[model samples]
Target: MLTPGDGGAGPAVPVGTRGPTVQTLATGEVFAALDASPRGLASADAAARRDRFGPNELPPAGRRGLWQDLVGQFTDLFAVVLLVASAITFLAYGLQKPQDVGTLQLAVAILGVVVLNAAIGFAQEYSAERTAESLQAMVPHTCRVLRDGERRELPARELVPGDVVVLEAGDAVPADCRLVEAHEVSVNNAALTGESDAVGRTGDPVAAGPVLQARNCVFMGTDVVAGAAKAVVFATGAATEFGGIFRLAAAAPRQKTPLQRQVASMARRVAGTALAIGAALFAVRVPAGQSFVETFVFALGVMVALVPEGLPATLSVSLAIGVRRMARRHALVKQLLAVEALGSTTVVCTDKTGTLTQAEMTVVQVWAGGAPHAVSGVGYAPEGDVANPQPVRGLLRAAALCCNARLVPPSDRQGWRVLGDTTEGALLVAAAKAGLDRVTEEAAAPRVAEYPFDSVRKLMSTVHGDTADGYHAYVKGAPQELLARSTSIDWGGERRPLTEELRAAVTAANDELASQGLRVLAAAWRPVSDSRPVQDEVESELTLLGLVGMLDPPRPEVSDAVAACRRARIRIIMVTGDHPLTAEAVARRVGIVSRPAPTVVTGARLDALDDKDLDTLLAAPGELLLCRVSPEHKMRVVTALQRRGEVVAVTGDGANDAPALKHADIGVAMGASGTDVAREAAVIVLLDDSFASIAAAVKLGRSVYQNIRKFLVYVFSSNIG
Candidate 1:
């Protein structure tokens, strides 16, 4: 049923129909098949093609109308039981005692409770659904493409097959396309493949592989990270690789929350018990010389009393209050039963970014002139100070000059914002903390020429100087790369010749920082006599300035929340798309894994395990950390945990997280950073994207379920009295 290109705005393509394999075909052949060229489709032809292929977008999800939602409110088991009880009471009273107004009043009151509860539930659900739909509109809606040989911006929905789309760093790929040209292109396929690392793309055709892995192809929903590319759209809308995932997620059957299942079971047992009691009373009283009408009336009263008529209303009020309490703590509950599900959560499979950490990179330490200086503050805000700024001034200057990212001053209510990569932004912030102004520094020693960072070199260099300094090249990149190229190091305001011992010491320092889960970047500089020296020549025999240790620091409140989870008998497992070292470091910092040598599983290792192996792993786990895992791996882990009788809660914020979010007992999505698809699939959205909020929600959820049980006990006990 999920056949690609089957249903859309244009003519339907029959399932199983074959066409030219786009990836295997030459660029010219692909262009011919699409009726397009390098010049791109003319306006008239583009319009016709648009009409034929339809808008390139996922079909809007069908929503339940107000009327349907109202009807749904009365479809619960308790509501149905109340309706039947009212009808039976009315019939028995009318047939046996037409003059009795009390029986009629009782029937009328029971029906009123049903109507009132249904109306209240309907209003709450209707409002919540509307809010969720409005949030979905916030996703990116436009992209750049070529039309009639001129580049123009257009709504992503209007893109069709044959369109020549342009992609740049930070741009989300709008549709599936084959690369016609690429310039050091690298894409973050986290949304599609769940790999946090950026993948390099090429225009050259691959001989054989899965289409998603082809070097010349780019799929929808992924973002370009480090380069530019011109790709010809070959698959649009639901026909793309992303669409297959969309269909898979859409088709996945929604399971009943644990609360719903338990509630239903309790309702069935209570109903059966009430029926048998009523029947026994009728049989015994009628045979003991009581009038038939009197016995029937007595039995009716007993059934009504046992039914817990106020339960529906009480449950609604309790859940509503729980929702409000969670909202105050920055967790928005989308479904009432999800609150109860959260209470029962035994394992929380949380992502590292935005959940455990701040998700904003910050420079915490700088090693320069043979001493370590700590940098204060945690985000883009330039309010922190560096310890001993004077000694590290050149190091900070080099960090600022070698970076391409810019920091925009706080505008309106917003604080400092980064215009480039977060890691680079951290460097700029560090420079600011060290009393270096990038604008002033650049003006004094303006850039001449530069070498941009590439996947192969893993380094970036910027030449900035006058004729006096002879064009000093400031370079920053992976510590290993920079250290290998450096022949000397700055020590105590003096340049020393790089010796074997010094090199080993630098390597040891880098390893120490890395072991602590910090991302280390080495800064070095060299004099380039040529105003425009070649990158390879300009990067050699440089003086190493020092190393900068940065980290997306763990949220200050998460450690307390993790401790609370432990106290509540809940196990927190970190499943992330980040590297093993980074994930392990964050996990240890957040207290998710206390042991120094916790089990860390990767996607590759997960793939190698069978279901039995996975089940065994889940069973034996003291504390589990899954790193560099894809969405499928997350879902599998959730499923395996469920099979072991543990209630699971999954937190995520990407398109790849949608399926697992839907599959979990309670899916918690990040309201601030989550994709539209992820938000739609989740049961709860953390407005602040904090682990602390999730812990608070669990506490409130437990209270909600406890209150419901207390109300049930009070109602049943009152009926007995």
Candidate 2:
């Protein structure tokens, strides 16, 4: 069994101890095992646990030293052949023709070629390693925990088993733990399990099964999607599921790129043919009365001449040129081989957000006071307008008031940017489009209190009050949730009872907007006479304010880019951590799936299939859309496609995407929004996060490969002459 101390400094617990599987143990039993209480361990106890458990981080796998990499550069087949020929020539010259320096010159020339190639290779590899190290520093490093019965933020690496950690929305879990108290807590376990759907947690114990399936346990590396919980850490570092997978992925050998394999094969064949020809020449000359030493030296000279001494340098230069060209087009190529690999990509597994579509959220449609209106423009620029603004002004106003996101005006080369949630930012932008100035509005009726949004409640309410109107609560959330809380609707500038027929009509409108791949949010307001009423009471009897339809619309250039991929015989498959319907809708809009009914697979459905089933699905002859997939699922999909002899390129922009990014033949990361870990893992970074740039990169990749082959032919032909 894996133990907390297996790879670190933790003290060994008793044999057959179930401390790590604290989910199965009762709350009192867990506290007993840890020698702690509900309040938490004392600072002194925490210090002892830290020494016992070591740092709460996965140990990095041992990497090859610079010396080893430098040595590897001169160890290829061609290099070995040249070394052997130089050695033989040196021996023959020393033994039979010490005074003559021709053979010595030849030997010196061959050694120079070897040393030059090794130096160039070493420099590139060292630079790449440094780049990766820099990128890893971008991930968040701190976590919140309770020590000495006081909640405080601490470096994640300081966490140890038995420590009590507090988890909230947007926080990455610091270590594996058993939930002591949970309130509507939902975790996105995509990094560990390859499932993008958020799983709810509870303090209740679960039956024995997969640890991930347990409702009472949360693992390290997963992010909290909503709610808050207090959990007792049972395992840290390599003992956690995240660390295990990290170790597994690290241990898996990196597959050689197609270009590398081909080059190796060509080098071996050239070396073999040169050796055979030299041997034949030696035999024929020696039998014809020539001295053995002279004949041998002559043969070695011939073999040395056949070796393309500048081939490595030329290949590097060609790839460097391609890299420079790609960089100008907004595609930064990190590795020389990746440039070649991109050309051979038969399938591009791309993420939807920030790659095919602009990552910015925008409000495109609005339904308020029984009227439908369209909001012009895209992104968070806040320069758009609604044709019929008066009817929807009330709804837009409530959405803006209920929002927490702040819109910052353009500054320092950046356009208008959102300071909080993108969804909330879109709402604020929509209100701006309807001529609602946030500054003026907030000044008139400042926010007095707020009932923060929670995943369980599916709504966020803010109490805004002034002397004139007393107090009013503005609420916004999922349309259905708001509809349920509301008792009346504002129609045609008048309030009316929410009848069954009207409710159905509102539901139909929401469905219609959702069907078009828009995210729908409803807004409502209530009159709260009490300045500080209970949150539950404040939410009662809300007046419905209709719905807002928003979407991260596909980039205008993407459709043409998708068409280009088709022309190049490259298949585009979208794999995202989004709803299946949304994924399909975006896929259609971007021209990825031409057929009206394409195969749409969800992560839940993917978990049920075996490797064979996945292979079968991949073998089907059309574009496939994978929704709500985790990093592991993406890696598996890429592996399956590769197993079938397809060259795969994957694009992503999160820390969770690092694994799949490293696993693919060519990984593309978004420069603007991608985490450092992802950028470090990827071979290419798109500065503008554009799909069109990827197509342009593919074109350049193909050209680079062709140019290398052309250079090889020219060098070999010249050597023969």
Top candidate when judged by TM-score against the true structure: 1
**What lDDT score goes with residue 474 in model 1?**
91
Per-residue error for 80 in candidate 2, Å, reads 2.6
Candidate 1: deviation at residue 156, Å? 1.1
**Once all C-alphas are superposed, what RMSD does model 2 give against the true structure?**
4.2
User: What is the overall TM-score of model 2 with all chains considered together?
Assistant: 0.85
> Would you list the C-alpha lDDT of every candidate in the order shown?
0.81, 0.79
Alpha-carbon deviation at 354 in model 2, angstroms: 5.3
Please give, for residues 3-51, the per-residue lDDT of candidate 1 as tens digits.
2353554333323211335566677766776667887778887776677
What C-alpha lDDT, on a 0 to 100 scale, does residue 7 get in candidate 2? 47
Q: What tens digits encode model 2's per-residue C-alpha lDDT throughout 277-362?
A: 89999999999999987888778767777878777766666777777788789877767777889998999998887677776788
Provide the clashing-pair count of each candidate structure.
Answer: 0, 1
